[model samples]
Each structure stands twice: as C-alpha cells, then as structure tokens.
Target chain A: MKNNFYRAVYCSRCELIGSPETITAELQSILATSRRNNRPAGLTGALLFANNCFAQTLEGEREAVERCFERIQIDPRHSDVTVLEFGPAVERDFTEWSMAFVGDPSATSPDPLAVALFKDIFADNHADSGAKVLLLLRQLVHQEDLWAIA
Target chain B: MNQISSQPPIQTDDQNIARSVIRTTTSDQAAALRESFLVIEDGAILLDARLRVMLCNIPATIRLGHYGAPPSRGYPLTKLIAHSSALDADARTTVLDRCSAMSASDLAGIEARLVFGDIVIRIRRLALGRLLLWVPASRAAGESSLHDPLTGLGNRRVFQAALAAIFTKPNASAALLMIDLDRFKQVNDTLGHPVGDALLRLVGQRLRACLSQEDVVVRLGGDEFAVLLQHLDGVDALGKRLIDLLSRPYLVEGHLANIGASIGIAVAPSDAHDPSTLMRHADLALYDAKAAGRHCIRFFKSELNARAQARLALETDLRRATALNQFALYYQPLVDIASGRVTEFEALLRWQHPSRGIVSPAEFIPLAEELGLIVPIGEWVLRHACRTAATWPADVRVAVNVSPMQFSDSKRLICAVADALTTSGLPGSRLEIEITESVLMHNNAETLETLHALRALGVSIAMDDFGTGYSSLSQLRSFPFDKVKIDRSFVSQIDGKGGSGREVVRAIAALGSNLGMTVTVEGIETDAQADFVETSGGHQMQGYLISHPVPSDMVSALFSPQSPIASAPNPEPVAPAGSRRLRGHDHEK
Candidate 1:
C-alpha cells in the first residue's frame, strides 16, 4: 500500500473480566488472530493491558478498522467497552506493530491518558488526545518489551 | 621557438591524462571508505536511495537489536528503528523524507536527531542515500557528564537513570532521599557565591561520607541533593546521620557558614515503583519536612499526597478569592485598660472562600506569602482597612499586619501606605503598621530607613507578637515604636500564681512605659487575664475578653459608647467551638 493512504485510528478501554492468566491467554490468541486477520487487510496497531483494563489503538483502512472494532466490542472476554478516541489520520501511528502487547500485573503507575479517557471522554483538558494516546501506546510497547525480558 | 612550443603542448596533454588517472583512483578510494566506518564506536547504518538498509555495522546491529529486532540487508530502516516512542511523528516523517525524495537543498547540511533513551541517532543524507550514526547521548560531554562539576556528585540525570535501573531489577527495594539545604541562600547573600559554592562542595562531601559505597549521591542542582540507597535496613538512622553531618558549620573561604538539610524519603515498592513518581513523592515529603520547621526529616505516606492536593486546591481558591474580592477585614477592639473603651481596632484578614465559608487567615496567609500573592493581598487589606477606618471616629486607630515579604521592597510598601493614607484622607496617626521582630532581623539599613520614614509620616508602628522571637529586646532598643503588643503566649500563661509569664509581662509593660510606648496585652480571654493586664500596668488589652473581631459593618456599633457589648463587664465565652477567635492569624515563621 502507498504511504499516503488514509486510515482511521480508534482507541477503546474495557474492563478485563477474567484472571490474569486467562487474560494473558486471551491476549495471545487475539494477537495471533489479529496478525492473521490484519496482514492482508493492511492493518497495524498496538494493545496495552495495565491493571484490569485493556486500551487498544487500531489503525487501518477506515472500513477495515471499523470492522475490526465491531468484533472487539462484542467480545465476551471484556466488559464496559467504551471508545476513547476515533478519528481520521494522514498516516498510521503504529505502522510497525501489527499487534504489540503490553500486560503488566503490577501496573500501579498511573497513565495520564488512560485515567482521563476512563473518567470522561470529552474531559481532555489537554487539547491533543490522539497524539497523547499514540505516544502512550508507544511507551507501553517499550515497557512490554522490558516485561518480556524480565 | 617552434621546437619549445611542441614540447609545451605535449606536456599539457600528459598533465590532462594524469589528472584523469588521479580521479579514477580517488573514486576507488571513496568506495573503500564505507568499510572504514565499521570501527567507529557509534552505531552506523548505511541505506540505499530506496530506503533499504544496505549495510549495518556491528554496533548498529547491536543497538537495533537492543531496541527491538535487528535488521538484515534490504530491511527498511524506518521499521527497524520504530521501537522507540521518543522519536515522535515529526521525526518519523523527516527520517522517511530524507531517505526518499527530500530535496538536497532542503536537508543539505542539516542532520535529523532521533533520541532513544540515552542513544542519539544523527541521520544525514549522503551522496546516494542516508547515513545514521547512533552515539551515546553523553558523548557530547566527553562520555562522563553524569557528575556535577561543582561537587563531583552525580547530577540529576544520573540519579534518574539509577532510579530507573533499580525499578527494573527484580526484588530490588531501595529508598529515594530528596534533601534540600536550608538557609543556604542567606549564606550566599551574606558571604558571596564563591563561599556558597564552597559550602555546597562541603555539603556534598559530607553527604558522600554519610552514605555507603552502594548509595548514589546526586547534586540535583543548587543546594538540592538526592540519594538512592540500596540494600538498606532502615532509612531512619541514615537520615539522622545525614541531617547531623549536613547541618554542621562549614569553613568556607575562611568564613564559617552554617546550613541545615531537610530530607524527604520514599521507599521503593511501597511508596512508588516508578522513578518520577518516587521522586515526586519524596519531594512532597521534603516539602512536609520544610513545613514542619526545617532541619527535619519526613517519610512519604499516602496521606501526604492528599494534603498536598488540598494545599494546591486552597492555593487555587486563594487566587480566585483575591480576584473576586472575597476577602474582608475584621476589627478586634484594642481597648483602653482604665476607660473600658475601644482605642484601636486591629484589622485581621478573613477570606470568605466560596464554599468553605470562612477560610482561616492562619491557613492561607503563609500560603499566600509563599505564592507571592501576599503583596497584592496585603495591598488590598491596607487600602480596605484605611478606607473603612476612615469612616470610624478619628481617635480609633486601625492596625494592619504587614508581612516581611511586603517590607522587602520598602519603596513599594511606602508608596502603598502613602497612597492608602492619601486616598482615604485618614490621618497617619489613626493608621498603625503591625510588624513582627523577624521583619527587622535582616538588619538592613535601608529597611530601618524605610521604618523611620514611615514613622516620620505620622503613622504609628507597633512591635507585634513581641517576645515570641529572638532579638525582642534588641529590636525594641534599636527601632522606635509607638506601641508594643505582648505576644499571646506570655498573656495566655499569666495568672495570680505569677511565674515567668507574669514576670515577663510585667517587665515588658514596664519597659514599654519607660520608653514612652503604649503596651497592649493580647489573648486576654478571661476576667482574671484582663485583671492581670490592668494590674501589670498594661495600657491596652486586646483579646476575646474585650471583644471578638467583628466585620467592618459591626465596627461602628462596637466603637459606639452606647453599645453595651463594647464594654460588657462579664465577657462572653472566650472561644466557642466555631467562634472566629479560634482562627487567630498567627505568622508562620
């Protein structure tokens, strides 16, 4: 695909209604399924799981991206599904990570964007939520690498 | 001549052929330069015009693998280096453009920098493609910029990196100590920056000596040092030792300079796990230590954050209160002992916070002073008091407390006072400026001159909260005053038993009389307290026993001779649970 292709970036947070192992199992399966389903569809994104919540950002062709979110919204493994941000972008922020995963069981450190999004979607006193979410996901990806190594 | 011309032409032709041969050799040498870059310490990656990694040296491959997965030949450079979040959207765009179709003139000599943790990658366009050199961020400082120049201790950046490393180590529990030097500014002001610098070096050395070999000491800029302790049993004994060692007097450039250290500690895994949050919590604890009177130590507790948030909320509210004109002055009648009548009304600050109803001045004044909001707030209080007291009887003076910060700039204070008096048309005699002994402790000749000038303007000055601080006697002798208010501490202790409190009160009153100054005894909350003040030769009595501070509208009624409450013989309850009397505005430090 050409680099100038338009894509939709969407982030949602939902409560993980299962044990840490079960969540981990479900996440691994999701990653397996996503990489399989997204490679031909030209989709790329990242998934971050801290505490008992899941924050995922999806970027792809607008229709394909929306279709993927539809499956996630109906998934029984999670509850309290709420979309934090949805918008059209010039390019994909997570082009390299087709399905990067971050799962921190002792995730006591607060994520500024996650807190704001969960509390109120429109209560972003900071103007640029999309950029902040992108950076936050990127940080989570780095942290996930560290967690894997540990 | 013909033969020479033929030789010159032949030489010219040979010279041209030699130049062409030299050019071919130089081109061959240019192709060999690529392999020579492999030995450099920095990571090197050479790319083709199509943006594929053509060559990745050993260091570059290691760094790429460190970030994520290493790239092989023909792999995209962007994908290989996309693991770091610090290279945000703009950097990504520039990297791609410089590799592809960006004009040579656009990016001609400029190199794009991508910072990933401690590694800084410099990307510049080569003749055919792009070259990226990844060097350690500290290379600009010759590889060891982690230590502070003045103290030879690690700088803040090193401390932060160490904190991060601790968090990554499994089962590692450490304590972060944030220590700040107290009265260091005074040393600098009195001695000089060179002396101050020497004192800092001495403090750093002492801190180092107090720590174990495993502990990392960092000079976090300007009298603030942070220590990370590992494999420690408890931080209490170490904290005590640090305080003692840091508080000792230091010989700096032949001058003995004294400074104290306040430490705030946060234990890892309990208080916080992350470096920034841990540092912040320790800093909050440091603030608490400073608040609890310097030269102390405090450990981080969950409640500290809530208290800090509460303070932040109050600070925001105070700024709004000033803007909305929500502050008012209450007048406590300073009455004559013999006449049983109000002589002066001490104007006390009262903040009508929108929701909290009445926020105590004791709670907000120091905060305001710290926030640098006191000057404007003080100006408002002075003008409001002068304007309100202008309506009162001319004989009843109005006393307004002035903070030391306000007096720092004597010109501004003088102008404010002059403006208030001039605009209100209130005689300077009816305006009294109440100042504590600490205000005069600076002993600045200019401050004394400012005081004398204020006195010369016919305005009365009272030595407020007297006998509560050092140099009370010396201040009384050095500065001219129209009145002296015995601090509430001594008055609260006075009774018929007559101990040091009564003796001290008697001596102060006698001294005030001897100097031809009116003496006002404060905190007289009972009949016995009032009687003690009268018998002890007090000229005026100011306390709840006389009259609780009433708002401006009630001032006229209190000062009226016909009003029975003004001179009530049996005073009401001194301090009801919710009475304003309990919210006395005491100076904090």
Candidate 2:
C-alpha cells in the first residue's frame, strides 16, 4: 500500500441529497458478497457525501476493488460514481477497517425509505459504517431515477 | 373567579351544562339523541362518554368476552381494561375520576399509560361520559411530532415545553435529566442500520422502562433524551434504575450490541428557573458526565455552574482589570526564619471590581484560567509586581505567582519577563517566579525550556504548591528549580494539633536539602507552626505572622530601622543545628 492516494471517497448520488444508512448498507452487502467470492481479497473503503455528491475510494485486490466500484456506479440505487483516487492503497489507511459515516446534514432525510433508513442508521450508530457506499445510497436510495435529482 | 385563576378547573353551576345541552342538542335534539343514541347498542356492544367500547368491538369480541343488553348504560370502567393484573385498581379509578370531572377542553390531567401486551397506550378521558380513548404513545404506532421518529420518545420541542410548564408552576419542583447515548455512531458504522435501529429501539424501550409514571421522558433529536422528574425520588434510585435497565444485552440482529446513556440532571428552581436554561444546564452536566465516562449519571451541581459563570465574568473582568488599571500586586513578606528579617516577598493579584468590593484572586484566578485569560493576566501580574518592587532593598527578591498557561504559552513569555526585568531596571537575579507542579506537567518541555531561559536571565524559579502533583520526585529531577514552597495545606497542619505535620515537614525539608534547594514553609501564621518548621530543618518561611500582604508604601516602613512595624535592630542570628535543638520553647508556644 502507498500513501499517495489518501484513501478517501466522494460521490453525488443520482439524486439531490443522500442517506447515510442506504449507502452504508449497500457498501456492506457489496463488500461482503465480493469477499465471499474472491479469496485473499479483503475490501476497505471510505464513503463521504457533501453538497449532493457521493465519493469514495475502495482499495484491496485490483480486481475485487474494481468490481466493488462497478456496483457503486451501476447499482440502480446509486449512480454517477466518479473516482477521486487511484493507485496502490495505503497499508494502514484505515489502521484496521471501519465505515466512516454521518448524515449528509447538508441534506435532510430524503424519502420514507430514506428517512426510515437514516433514522435507523443514526439510532444504531452505524451511521458512520458502510459510509463508502452510503454517500451514494443516502442520495439515490429513494430517487425514481438516477439522473432526476442529480 | 374561574376566568382569573389560570389553574382553575372548569366552573360549573347548572347554567353552563344546561345551556350546552340546550344549545347543542336543541329543544327537540334530546329526543333525537335519545332515539339515535341507541346506535351505541349494536351487537351486544356499549359506548360511554369517552366512546371506548363499553363492550368489546366486533374484532375484539372473538378474543374478549362480550356484555349483554343496553351497554350504553355505565359499567365500572375498570372491567373494560385488558390484562388487569398489570395495573392496580386504584390507578384505574383515579383515571376515571379525572376524566369524568374534566370538560373536553383538556386531557392532560386525565391521561394514563396503559400497557397492553408489548404495546404502550396513552389513554385520554372522553368527555360525554365515563370513558377512556387509548392510543399507542410509541412512534412505532404512528404518533407524530411529539415523539422523535428515531427514539420513539417525546421530541425536544415537547420536552422543552414540558420543562417550561413544570418550572412555571408555583411550589413545583423537578430534576431536568439529560441523556446522551455514548459512541452510538460507532455501532452504526461497524454493524448496519437494521442492527443499529434495532439497538436504538432497544435502548429507547429500556430507558422508557426505567421511568416512573411521575417522570416525563423526551428525545431531543439525535442520541439525546431529557427526563423531567417532578420531585425526583432520589439520585441513587434513578441512577440504579438506569444502570439496571441497560444492564441487559440488546440483541441487534445475531450479535448483541452494547451501549449506554450518560445522564446529567439539574433540579428545577434549584439549578435553574427558566426552562431553556435548565435544559441547557442539564445538557452541560450530561456532556460532562459523558466526558467523565459512559454508563454514568450525575446530578446538576451549583458549583459547576458558578465556576462556569465566574470564569466568564472573570475572563471579561481580567481583560478590563488590566486595561483599566484595576489590578494591584499586594506583597506578603517572606521572613528569613533565623534573622526574623524580611528577605523576599510573594506578590499576589487583587482585583478592585467596582461593584464587588476587592475581589480576591483565590476566587478569580481559576475563573481566569477557564476563560483563557490566565496567560495575559499572569503576564500583567509578573510585569507589574516586578516593576513596583524594583525599588525594594537589593536582596529582597519578589516572587510573582505564575499560572501554567503563561509558562507553556511559547517563548513569548520568556521575552515578556525579560521585558519587565529590563524595563523596570530590576536585575533578573532579584526576581523569582512561583509556579505550581501542574504548570510543569501541563506542558513540561516548554515550561522547562522557559524556566531555563528565565534562569539564563538570572531569575530563580520555585515550584509553588509543591505537594499537589503526581510523580513529584521525577518531576524534581526533570526541572531546573532553585526552591520549593511547602504547600500551605501541609504547613497549616505542622502543629501536632491533630496529625503528623512534623514528619511531613521533616520529609519535605529533607527532600529539599537533598535536592539542593531552599525549602520554604508557607502560611506559617502561628508561633507554634513557625517553631515547628525551624526545629524541623525548614530553611525559609512566608506568612501573615511575618507580615500580611501590603502595598509598595508599607515595604519601606516595615524594613526601615526606626519604622513602626520594623523588627528590633540587629536581630539575633540563629544557626541551623543549634536552632533546631534549642528553640526557646517558651517563644515556640
């Protein structure tokens, strides 16, 4: 792992706002599914959402990480994934592994599902986990279409 | 009378009721209602004033047994309640009385919490007759506005309103309890929202179970709840309830989650009279509790708020105290134990508040520190005390008490001391700085380096309030100090009046000698305390017995040969070994 890429993620969900829980839930599922399939590959990423944007950097095995990124980009629940960092990930970037999460206070909880999801994430303290994917999920989770809010 | 009295109940004379029935029902309406009111008598069912099913509703009939005949007629309201064992009969009667007596204008005084299975219902009195209308108070059942959608407890707005009502009631008392879930976000990140929500909902239920009927629990948005306990039973009891409630494991998904609420409470009217103010104070107390540790509960204390308010006032005053020349240094003479002559003086800051007649530094020094004004206040004290004492006799070094903020405040402090020394024309060697052990520990590197730089200017440094810090011996080795002032707490106890002040003074004196620094006993006001220190190998002393802190004008008078407070000319000198062995025991007592 190299220190060059600072290991951070940013994204604008397909919508105008984001939900911290949805992004985190999707990230956890995607990472969990990816890890179950790929051997010797442990995925690590950070999710950040600000000003209606979702961005993150997932780093692990080249193939595992790229596949995770693909899910974030095309998973109808999310869209408009822009890669902010690429290259070898830092060895102790996370020190261990964690989901850095918080509500995009910049935006209110979006829809009933988004609101319920946000409330659940916050109440459970998992608002900070799965943030890598939540950055997009918080915004795109309830949107009827990806490009509508964006 | 009813109009003028705010808390007055609905005044009824027969006119109001008769008028309501006549106006609402009309002359022919009573006949119509008597005929159509029978609509409540369908399917062996009944209706009462509150419209609660006097008999079971159709859906309820399958599970609950039904009543026969015109059920619109009254039955004991208690029989309608399910799971009668959960609540006492007296509680049901009180709910009935309040609801029956109150007009439809208010329901607050007649609400009862009815627990049916796992669901909690808020039942209000129905006005037409003796009846109760029940709705689940929990947000899970669709309560809006009053409850936080997340915590399922009353929201902050409602809590604020509750506090206001409680405070405004004359003779009313309550404790404002603030609760914050510690590190809750960590759970959200590591687990998932589903599990997280499960954890939060569990916490809410647990906290709810901890509350008594007299208590009101409110959720203030995220991870925080305020409980208003009117005439709280006892802090220990409530605290025990919280601990015991959270003691159980919350099963979030497959794994059990662990988290706890840090609670801080301020008693109403005692801590604060205003609602928002009390709420805020409880919040501050809660924050402090959380900072102290999780899974803890603390009651609001006046001293904390006093210290806070005092700090703010002092911080503001200190800035003005310096600019307006309200700061003055009072010197207390440090006597040479053997010569009985004033050799050095400790400089203290006094604030002449226009309204608060001569505010003592003991009360305001801490206030200054809290406000971050200690750095500037300390500099003023150091510079001014040195400037004023510059005219004293050459050997009389002035010791200015320095705060930790000043010592660790970068090299600028060293320069300020130098400036004071240079500007006053007082030799650096003639000035000494007194600092507490905390000053060194707060930021040792800067304090040590700063002390060395001041030493380079020829000023001596003495550790003030020596006994109060940790790892004293190592700290002694780490710093380059010239003297140590035995803490006043120990010196005041030096007399064998109650404890072993002799052994303490001896050990401290021995430590100072071995460390190669002058050992001074401070606050030696009594003759016995002075004799004890000298006999115990203490080298120097400073106290009121030597002389109280005085202005610059009194220094010349006290030290002058023929002045009123001056000691005898050519006072007899005493030796270290002989003085300890033969102190005039008569003079000692």
Candidate 3:
C-alpha cells in the first residue's frame, strides 16, 4: 500500500496566448480549477508560476497523480511539458493545500528570484531538478508565512 | 396504489424521490423499486421542477464529486457546471445556458444529451415535472475507450488519433518507434500469465518514465508497444535508452523475469509522410531488428524496404520450388585420413533456380526455416539421400543435415526418417543425421527423446558445425554423438602460421577422439591443411580439397577404380607419408 503513494513533477512554458490581463486570469483559473478538482481526488500539490514558466508537483495515490498529470500535459496553456520526476514518495510535502500557489497572482511583473530559479532549473539537464524545485517552493512558502506573521 | 400500501419504507433518504414516485405501490413493491434504482450501474440524479437536486444515489454523488461538484439534496442542478473541472469554460457556459433555457415541455422528450470532454449525460423527463439525469457507468468509471485497461497506456485507437493529429500540420517532423519484447513468450510459458501481466505493466511504466511528456507511448497489444515522438532530434539516443531500460530484468509476483526489447524506428517526412506507410516502414525495420537478433535497434532505411520485397519474392519461389522439383541434393565426400578413402558423403541441398542457377543454401536455408518449409524439404533430402546411398558401397555412409525445425515435431521427424529408410530399402546404420549445436542448445527433453528414438532406428548422429555455437563443449558431454564436424572457419585459419586456430582444431580433434567420436575437419582447401588434419588426429577431411559437391550420378565416378581421387593423387608425396602413418596408427586402435 505504501508503494501506491506517488509524486510527479513537471515544468512547462506558459502558452496562454492573450493579453497580460487574460494570461493572469488564465493562470488564476488554472490554480482555482485544479484546487477544486484535486480536493475530491485527495491530491495535494504546489504550483510555481513566474516569468511565463510553470513548475508543479502533485502527490497522491499513483493513479490519481498520473491522471492529474495527464490532464495537465494536454492542456493547451502549457508547452514543452517536461516530466522531471515521477516515482513513489514516502510522504506528502504540501498536505495543507490542494494546490498551493507559490508566487503573487496579481503582480504585473515577474518575481526576479523565482524567475532566476526557473532559468537555473530549465537551463541545466540535471536529474535533481525536480528535487531542487520542491526545495525552493517549500522555502518560499515558509518565508511568505513569516512575512504574513510580521 | 394498493401495492404501495403493502410496501416497506425506504431506509436511505437519497431514495426519497423514488419513494414518493412509488407511494401508491405496496410496501414490498416500494422496497423492490428502491433497490432496483439503487442497484442500477448508471448514476441517476432526480431533479425537481425547479431543477433542484431533489434526490440522488451514491453513484451520482461519486460521479459528480469526480467533476468537482458533489451534489447535495436541494442543490441547484445548473450550479454544478460552474464548479466542474471536467468541462472547459465554453462547455460550462453551453451547459448552463442549455439548462436555464429548458422548458418543462422540452424535458418531456425521450432524451436531451450533453457532452463535455469525455463525459456524456442524458436527461429524460419523469412524471410530475421531475427529470432524471443518467450518467452511463463507462463515463462514471473515468476510463476512456482509448486506454489499455491492463497497463493504463493508450490503446491502438489512441495511437491512431495521435498519429492523425500529428499529420494535420504540414511540414511536421516526428518519429515512430515500434518495439517488441523478446523472450516474453518464454516468461509467460514458464512463470504464468499473472507474472506476464505484471511485467507488461512495469514495462509500460519504464517506457513512460524514459519519455518526455510530449511523447505518446501506447501498448499496441500483447507484448508489443509503440511510441510517438514530436521531434526527430536525439531519436537514436532515445531508442537506445528504451532498449536498455526495457531489457532490464523485472521482478514480478515473487518471480524474476528477464526480457529484452527490439526497436524499429521510422521518421516522418523522411521515411514517409503518411501514417500507414510510416507504420509499415517501421514494421519492416522491426523485422530487420528481430532478424539481426533481439535487443538491438534498427532505423528505417529505403534499402530495407527493397530487401523485404526481395525476401517476399524469394519466399514465394521457395514455396513453389519444393513442389516443382527444383531442389537437388549435392553429395560432398568426407575423406577418412587413415584409409585415404571416402567414408561418408554429406548430402547438401542446392536450389536449381531456373534463372538464378544454383542459389546458395546459406541464402535460402534460413528463409526455408522461417517459412516452415524446412520440414518437408528436409524429408525430401532424407529420402533422396537414402535412395542414392543404397546404390553406393555398403561401407560408405550418407549424412543428411537436419534443421532444428525438423526436430520441433519429433514424431513427424522420426516417421519421415523411418519412411525414407523403408522406401529406399537402405539400412539405418548407413544413414547419419547431422545436427548443429543449436539443436542441443534448446535443451528440450523432447529433442533428447527424439535423438534417442533416431538412434534406436540404428542411425548415427553427428554434431555438425561444432565450435561455432555457445556451450559446444557442454553439449558434447551431454549427448553422445557419433561424430563432431569442426566448423569451416577453424580449418580456413590453419595456414601453418600456427595461431590459436590450429591449436583449437587440435584440441577439438583430441576432445572428440577421447569422447569416442569421429572428428571431421571441414573446409580443408589446401594440401597443407590436409597434412595438418592428419597430424592433429582428425579422422576425416571435407572440403574442396576432397571434391566439390557433385550430382548423384557423378558420385559413382568419384569411387570408380580409375578415379584420380580414389587413386590417392600425387599432389605432394610428403603428405602421403603422414596419412600413411596416421592410417597405421588408426589400425592399432
């Protein structure tokens, strides 16, 4: 039964062809829709979108995770959908949110730090890129919580 | 109405609408009605006159929840589309519009259908302005017909759809790889179907893990699979990676299963623009890969198509050749070094093509084997050789090469040999059946039993083309053979340069002798080669140096009293001395 718990990570370039406002609305819609769908499927994950690039991780039962990934891969809004990692996981990292957002949705400009991390991850064909993305998202979430408290 | 008075009350509130509808029935009738509605495989939701969710079963609740709209009693039905993840924005708007505009009269129709993504829903009117929404079980299970149920990979339908989608764009460059698993049948036969199924699922996972998300992998059914790549760059590396990953051993159901993959690739716009042609080219390349030996990758080449065409034509010709009497047996004498006389004549098959003259056995034998024509052709050779050998001296034996296919059905093979001996009126002792190491490599008990049966018929078995296949030494120790024929490559290597080839021939000759088997060195094309065979303790020498394989009529001329070959020609006087000394040494034994 433990072997059934799986996690998958994928990164893609945003191909939402529209104005800035429309792209922002599309991005928000993706997050809201995925959250609504993931809750019923018992899937927990986080999405990081910045500089017209997106990296996401989903964790759940193997079948659920794979089905969710399949839908994401076919979505017209994403291009060059590269699967970085897909294997069994010991435990979930983002159990609190159905789909936690990592960057500000309303910001007109991209976050420089998030954009830099995206470039680093995509530029090198390293096997650990998925792990690196997960670590970055977890740190960012913790920092945001600290800021909210302050 | 009287039936409703006798019915018991329904236990679940979800069936309240059913209870209300059947209120006039007896208590038993009401309970049965409720049970029947609940037991229906399709999800059913009852909506009130205002399109409110008046009642629903567990199937409906689960199906709605999967679309992100878990229905509750009294929840407005039109609001479900707003929260549905199964539908896009346009589909949601369309569904909402259709529901809001529907009149009570429109709901009275047989069925009002709605489609969003792969889900289909049908709404039908019930009595008293109530409407029932039916979601078939197939959609409720969330499994599309495009998927393989066992592996969750896309099925052939999905593959065809993806292929058509690719070609819709002009100037598109993509590649298709056709993969077949080797030794999977053996695994299934040895380990059972459960393990084979588990291994296939694991194979699908490994294939998906190695490919990009943009690429599509599908189970083409059974142990064969295919992949469609969006780009042609790095295709070779991807093919090699797939072969490597799939060939790794799989542990399934407490059993370790080992299988290998052979890949054939065809690139679009280069191999062919259309889908069917591309698939055919890939299949042809796959044939080449499997023929080249399993666990390798082959790319589609224009020449492969041509070669395939040629092979097809040759196959047709081979099929007719057997019945047309175009096949003839050529006899090549194996000279005994000790007596300097012909002891046995190996019957070799030659295809006397009308236009092509004599086609080499090397070219057509494998083709015959693949087409399963080897068995009948082998029977013909056996019969012809036996009849011809009966006319020769009684001491002279005839050796006919038997293909591995002939051994597949040992009963038929034994019957064929028996029929040949009986019809030809030749003793079985004079007929030797020569088999290669491959026959023993299969290691089937049936083959061993067949060998014993043949020996029981007073026939001698020779291990032909030895030292060429793997585990030759072990094979000799396992089966007691009458003779061992050293492959021609070793004899061609004996140039007196004295490399390992000479030492190898010498060692094998000594091994065969110690095992109480006759050793014949093949391809002795030179006088020096003959001298070397004599010195290395070989019993017989067979090659052009002995004589070219002649027709059956000419076989008698070779043994005639005045024959130059039978007179022990004066090619080299010193060579005779070694042969004479070996002859004397053999007499002592």
Interface RMSD of each: 31.0, 17.6, 10.2
In candidate 2, position B243 carries an lDDT of 57
Ranking by lDDT: 3, 1, 2
lDDT of 1 at B12: 28
| Poorest stretch of ten by lDDT in candidate 1 chain B | B1-10
Binned by DockQ into CAPRI classes (incorrect, acceptable, medium, high), candidate 1 is: incorrect
Clashing pairs in 1: none
What are the DockQ scores of the candidates, in order? 0.01, 0.01, 0.03
lDDT of 1 by residue, B1-589 (tens): 0111111121223334222211111122122323333344455555655666554454554544434333444567678557534466665565566555432332444235555455556554433333434444244642334458899777664464456445533445888889999999999988889889977877887787666545778898988999888755769888887886676445445444567889999988788756677888999999999999989999999999999999999988988997898998999988777776676899999999778999888899999999999999999989999998887765778999999999888999998999999999888988999999889878468778989989977899999999986755878888778999999999888764745789889999999999999999999898878777788988988888767888887666555343244223432233332122222222112
What TM-score do all the candidates reach, one by one? 0.57, 0.45, 0.58
Candidate 1 off by > 4 Å: A1-150, B1-145, B168-172, B212-214, B230-234, B560-589
Off by over 4 Å in 2: A1-150, B1-175, B179-236, B240-263, B266-275, B281-319, B338-340, B469-471, B497-499, B560-589
Interface RMSD, candidate 3? 10.2
As a whole number from 0 to 100, the lDDT of residue B71 in candidate 1 is 41
Cα error, residue B423 of model 3, in Å, equals 1.3
lDDT of 3 by residue, B1-589 (tens): 2333333343435445333432322223124333434565656665656777644555654544434324444567777556555667787676555554452555334236777666676554433344556666665443444468889787675465456445534556889999999999889878889888988988898888887545778999999999988788999998987886676545455444568899999998789766777889999999999999878999999999899999999999999998889999999888788777677789999999998789999999998998999999999999999989888776789999999999998999999999999999889999999998888756368888999999999999999989996745878988889999999899888885655679989999999999999999999888888878889989988888767888887676455232233223322221232232211112233
